[model samples]
Target: MRGPEARPRFGLSLRLLALTLVFVLLAEALVFLPAIGRARVVYLEQRLAEAHLALLALEATEDGMVDGDLQRRLLGHAGAVAMTAYQSGFFRLRLGPDMPPRVDAAYDLREVGLWPPVGDALMVLTRSQPRLIRVAGISPKDPRVAVEVTLPEAPLRRDLMRFARRLLGLSLIVSLIAGAVVYFSLARLLLKPLSRLVAAMRRFEAAPEDPGRLHTPSTARHEVGEAERTLARMQARVREGLIEHARLAGVGAAVARINHDLKGILTTARLESDRLEAQTRDRDPDLARTTEGIAQALDRAVALCAATLSYAGSELPSARPRRLAAHHELTLAAQRLHQAHPEIAVNLDCAVDTTLSADPDLLARSLDNLTHNAAQAGARHLTLAAHTSNHQTTLTIADDGPGLPQRARDNLFQPFAGSARNGGTGLGLPIARELTQAMNGHLNLHQTTPSGTTFHLTLPT
Candidate 1:
């Protein structure tokens, strides 16, 4: 949908950009979740290592004991309220408060696996107040000894929160940068070309007949490029269709103007033919029969004239089949053609005669139209060849007149578009073909070239 009625909801470009950000942030979250958990474990391991070092400091002191002030200093340096190391289930070194203050929680670091629990880390981060936590693990300096530390979770949580802020800021920056890069890259590579196609459709919809509005094929070798090429072809056809439609519309208006007059003329001819037939009926049977055929042809003509306004709309009326002498009808058509244009010579190839079951009036009208078309095309000599086989009769109307042109041959059977000459309505062959089909038969151009043109008309016999 185009024009000024519907507003744009959102550009695909912006949606892609937003999706990129969301995806990037999700990727960062994937990294951030496990990383925060591991960060907690690393912090605990550092405290254990410091506790071991502090034990070494105590061993270096006189009597393997340190005063309260020095002990507190060592413990504070390790970021622990109390520190102890046990070898073979016995304490090797101990420092700080006698019992620490009833541990709030205890963790065996050795069984904590490769990384600290994410749930535990989250819990520390969410806790409102600091509480003591006991951590026990193999001492970093001596794996054979177990080290335990009493530490305040507040410090660990503070470090974790600080790390989160820094990481979150970094992730945002990276997401924005990556998102923008991806957005613009896709916009240039795909979105812009897709937009071009959409825009071409809208533009074409606005003015289909404007050749300038047709989509130009881009050299891109992708599916979109193929679409561009296909769109060009489609627009070309649409332009042709519009042109044909306009021609038909003009033809319709002309027909509407003349329909009444043409019907009046046909009716007058039918009445006159009837009167003539009545006058000659007893005197000359053949003349009366010929006059009857003329009146019947006029009746068919009036019906055809009524439908002329349809332009491609209505179906031809039903065929009223009758047994007729095929050879005689061909001769009659040939005589009519020769009389209309004495400059052309007409030959009949009526070696065998056969009875044909067809609407006599329709058959004559079709034959008349084909022969007249050949004559009008500047033919010098015409041949009406007839034969019967397999209960069907074939009439080949061959003309030696510069054949049909290539342009005419291409659209030969199409109404209003196959004429080679100027001011031609191009309905002759189409009307003939349609009449032939109405009789459950066929009319086809058998062959055409610079040498001559031949049309094959087949009917049931």
Candidate 2:
């Protein structure tokens, strides 16, 4: 649903829902966990303390334990049965076996003072029915005879469950209220801006030319500001690109119409040059050679005009790849360049004396553009060279000129985008590069220095 001139689209509702879920989950966990811990701790502590007091109440006699009433009271308090078992001179009282399964045996025994204090927390075997005895003195009246009391755990379980439910309910309510408050606060502060951005996007979708603005609230230098700026820049660039594309399509159509008239003009020039050649019969070889060169130059000019027309109209030019003389093409390009700019000197170096299987006319045109670029860049001298290595042929054009600026170098082959140079149409490099590539060759900027720049073209041998 994205288009040019659209504003920043923000997903505030999704973000709010996500944040609400997270906060609700966190609050629920927090209350649920601590409440459970506190309930367990309070139950265990009370049970243990009561067990210690119960053991103290029983008195031991010579015959057996006394004060049965105290033992029953201790059992009731402990929610568990107390047992007495005698062995030798000592009498022991241990906590009852078989507690409720819901009650943790570990927590229950830990609450009672009967549990031992050692390296590890003493675990009372509530399940293992053990017998314990309360020892008495060597007298019948002594309240030290062993006695048993069964502790009921049902009351403790009921109380604990009720307390747990109440705590759970309270915690749930608090969690929901807190989550709602957090969600609303976030919605007002953060989501409001996003909602506005979304509304702006909707307006833009309705009418692209007059898209709504996405003004960011200056609250914090967070991701929100960065996102706003990025969206704005992207929208502006896309809008400009669409407009530029429309203009180019129109220009392409207009150029197609003009190309026909321009071709006719070049054809007239060709006929005139041919007539001049037919009339000229010089006795001097130098004059003949000069006339021949002029004739050849005019032919090249016509060829270039045709190529330019093809380029403007986006027409693909035909290629005739064959074993052609490299020196001839180089000479023709250099001579044509010289005619164009007599001030600049041209030099040729043929390191590899071989013919290349490529379109000579296209290659020459590529070289012509490179030379013109160098001249335009203020080059005093130009050198054209050819080399062969590993079954590949390479042609290099070097210029003793002020090198291309960084901006131009980065996008050297992009059309209609000039670097720092004034009055540059920025199509020469692109056209040259396109022609070279169409001929199954590659073009690249070999190197650039303060003294000059060099362009390299490669074709398969």
Instruction: Identify the leading candidate in terms of lDDT.
Output: 1
Q: Mind giving the per-residue lDDT tens digits that candidate 2 earns over 77-114?
A: 65545543333446564434334223223222223232
lDDT of 1 by residue, 1-461 (tens): 45644736777877888889899999999888888888888899999999999988978877878999898889889999888899999978888877567889999887885445777888888888869999999888888889999988989999999998998899899988999898889999889889899989888999899999999989989988998999999999999999998997788777766876888988998999999999999999999999998987887778767656555456555899988888898999988987899898988887645777899889998999899999888889999988889999888999987889888999998887898665466888988998999998999999998878899999998
TM-score for each model: 0.63, 0.53
Estimate the overall C-alpha local distance difference test score of candidate 2: 0.64
TM-score of 1: 0.63
All candidates' lDDT scores?
Answer: 0.87, 0.64
Residue 77 lDDT in candidate 2: 68
Error of 1 at 387 (Å): 43
Question: Using alpha carbons, what is the TM-score of model 2?
Answer: 0.53
Task: Mark the 10 consecutive residues where model 1 has the least summed lDDT.
Answer: 307-316
